[model samples]
Target: MSNYTPTKFATALLLSVLLAACGGNDAPAPETPAAEAAGTAVEPTTAEPALDAVEGEPALADAPGGDPAPADPGAPAAAMPADAAGLVAGRDYEEIPGGKPLEPLNGKIEVVEVFNYVCPACAAFQPLVNSWKARLPADVRFTYVPAAFGPRWDPYVRAYYAAEAMGIAERTHDAVFNALHIERTLKGERGEDSPAEIGAFYAKHGVDAKQFASTMASFAVDSKYNRAKQFIVRSQANSTPTMIVNGKYRIKGTSFENMLENTSAMIARVRAQGSAAE
Candidate 1:
């Protein structure tokens, strides 16, 4: 973690975002009529400690590899069903101010998932997001931004960046979620795992222990973490599994499935705008 401490203003801003997010006390009521209407199961809210653990064991580093290549962006977008029409802005999604730009700006619309590895809601939403990503058109790009809510959450974010730097993120991303939610090996509470222990988890996935440790602390990983944190703040993403389309709209589906449906519509919406602009 950067020795850099959050300033009072930054901390206040993050707290405000968190309080406004789903995990907060004022979070939306589960099993709302909208969710039932969408035929979606509501995820239960639990009052566990704020911290969650990372999953996996560390192993010796093998040969270095390149970053995971972007998925093919040329496929045609899937069509939205008739029922997916009229997704309202405030109800179904919210628009961001001064929209964020796509990273690497590959001339395609971007979809960003701001999530945390330790969030149970995020874990539950992963498969759905994965399926949605698979169907994305060639003109759309998808990426994940791990949230850093506090010190307890910092290590997992570091782990994500480390794996990315070592080129193992694509292969091991789901495994980390399984470790936390299924295997129950990684804990989220403070002081559960040292940097070395966390490094061991990645090492088990073929990330060299020493190299993983070095990379986790390296300037490169730090830069990525900083960027992710900024994105979360700028996007005002207070909840896990939050989806942003072209960095202009924040999607809010009544149900998990509905969220994906809304995501599809937003992508189409953005694609149309891009075409019109050209």
Candidate 2:
């Protein structure tokens, strides 16, 4: 695990990556001529806080852990009906070559969401993801990985790590989203909030501001944040609100609702495999 210490050079590199990812400010770009002609608004791929991609270029194949294993030829059949709703590997999801969850699961299947608090799409998807998570069986484990695309997003990532360390992540997670998206009190753009400012926000939810600030800069938080970056890279999830199931498959769907449905099917498939193994 790399201990994160912000050097002038590293900070500058991160900021450069951020600028490249967004092309500029946080506003959503206007639809292109082709998109308008097609009668569909072209959702900005990296425009605005929520729509932006991760920092640095995508390097999924070179990520640590190597490539994910090939699909098991003798694998048990998926439990879901092989109908339209059924997830088709490579079509609805891609297997990670060396993809594995951040933490080992003693026996439970792992489901992870790679997201950013500043992302508008993530804010929109939060309630849906939350509802799905609440209904997960005990045999399935769910966790979140906050995206650290650049210096602008570093504070939010630090805030998340600090909250998790303080055991207040769950309590304050939704509140953070609401603060950014609903209330519009917290600006999602980079450089909008200092560590001190973010600490004050957490203080409202019972976290000590001073401790939060200290923790955000601690070696432990840095390690966690670094691990999160690796996970995002390995998952090959370029956009916000992407899901990975069992660290093996990156779920894909035409729409948000489709993605959730696909996720449910994938969870069922993994559960079935575990049961069969037993």
Candidate 3:
């Protein structure tokens, strides 16, 4: 909700992200790590784009009344499974973003995006993110792991989590991405993206000042960040916007076009046998 978007990995978290992985199926219930694990540790989804529309920009929009939105022009994102009921049957695997040990992805198509605010790649992927998001069916669950690849990425995460806490994400989520990615402003001269400064940005977006402050400093937000850390470690990814389908499959941007198609196909294939055990 804050004007600044947080990076996937913070500088201090790099070593922690590369730490030990929880090996056993500690929690269990079917497909995704959460359902199969004796319980579930489902993470957050791709952020809602902050909604600042120009006269002519392709958008990531949801069905206002229940209509499927337009598909991205670049390429098909992760596709639905061949058999709608077979989504859970895809091959099971876990990936670590940047291949640095992060957390353990149990099953399911675990799509974790490791983003840094300053990264051009993340920005380039922003416009198309909405289109890709709309197509996901029930069989798949997605998560966003804010990464502070370095000092530059830290503030963005702080702002991201803060907005989540304040419940202003719906209003300011896409705005922050657009501001940083599309606009390409934000020189970050004097740590202007700091929590306090970012809070101001959220206020400008229409979030109340008191709520924004509370959300930024809340224990819940910190806990959310902690969970994200676990996801980062399990995926072993080293960059932003990386997709780990079913933990076992790794998909990058070049492959992303096909990645979505294959993932959807895989999900449908798996889900057909039986429903995901929740």
Candidate 4:
């Protein structure tokens, strides 16, 4: 009886291990869930700041926990969102040292998103971005900066610049996202895509496929590529879908919704600072 008991216990443990092993996967599922597709996750009731803290700053902290910090006394009172008061530095956002706008300010508050086409996170963030940007005031400038972190990511950066060169970037942006994340046509993730193949996708949007492919490696596209790399390096943005506000603050929100809210608050902060200077 004692010997049987030991064997039964060992068998039970083996069965549990087998079940866990069968459930695990080294590869991504063929399809992402709808919530993840939208890039939304069930956030905790008590939110904490992200660990992507600023460089040279103390290690990422869980401070200012439970609720956001109160509104900055220096933030402009007018044109600010109600939640702006809850913004806490190092948690909601971080100041970039010696940061400069990727483009000339030209009297506009610049907000740039450093993203990658192969990034599932960026794909999920797109819908939210579309909605948020639509509500932006005329004085605010929103820019999309595609990240070329490696060979797999670089082709899409080229594709973006090439499309922009042909004046088809805005028109084809959503289509590109759909092709990659929703339709699963482009092989950006597998690093199996080429300029010609990607150009073929853009061709459906009225671009000449051959010209599009050629432009991917054009001198102009190369220039944009180099500048983007430099700007990302200097900003210390190591993740896709990172939001930089007025080239001064890098947002690190607790969730997708929180990110947009923080961006709005930062915008107000910049506007207020501008007014004070005047």
Give the number of the best model, judged by lDDT. Answer: 4
Better of 1 and 4 by TM-score: 4
Candidate 4 residue-wise lDDT, 86-121, digit = tens: 677777787888877888888898999988766655
Clashing pairs in 2: 50-119, 50-120, 67-97, 67-98, 68-96, 68-97, 68-98
Error of 3 at 250 (Å): 2.8
Per-residue lDDT of model 1, residues 130-186, tens digit only: 667888778887888888765656788888989988899987777776665445466
Model 2 Cα lDDT, one tens digit per residue, 4-98: 22243234333433343456646432112232112133331232222233365346442377679899899997754363446776657888877
Residue 85 displacement (Å), model 2? 8.3
lDDT tens string, model 3, 133-251? 67787546665567655555666776678876666665665666555533434433123455665666677877776677667667877776655554444454445555655544454
TM-score of every prediction relative to native: 0.69, 0.71, 0.55, 0.72
User: Would you list the rank order by TM-score, best first?
Assistant: 4, 2, 1, 3
- Indicate the residue-level lDDT of 68 in model 2: 90
Off by over 4 Å in 3: 1-110, 188-192, 210-214, 246-248, 253-255, 272-275
How much is the lDDT of residue 12 in candidate 3? 16
Question: Residue 100 in candidate 2 has what lDDT?
Answer: 72
Clashing pairs in 4: 71-85
Taking all chains together, the TM-score of candidate 1 against the true structure is 0.69
The better candidate by TM-score, 2 or 3, is: 2
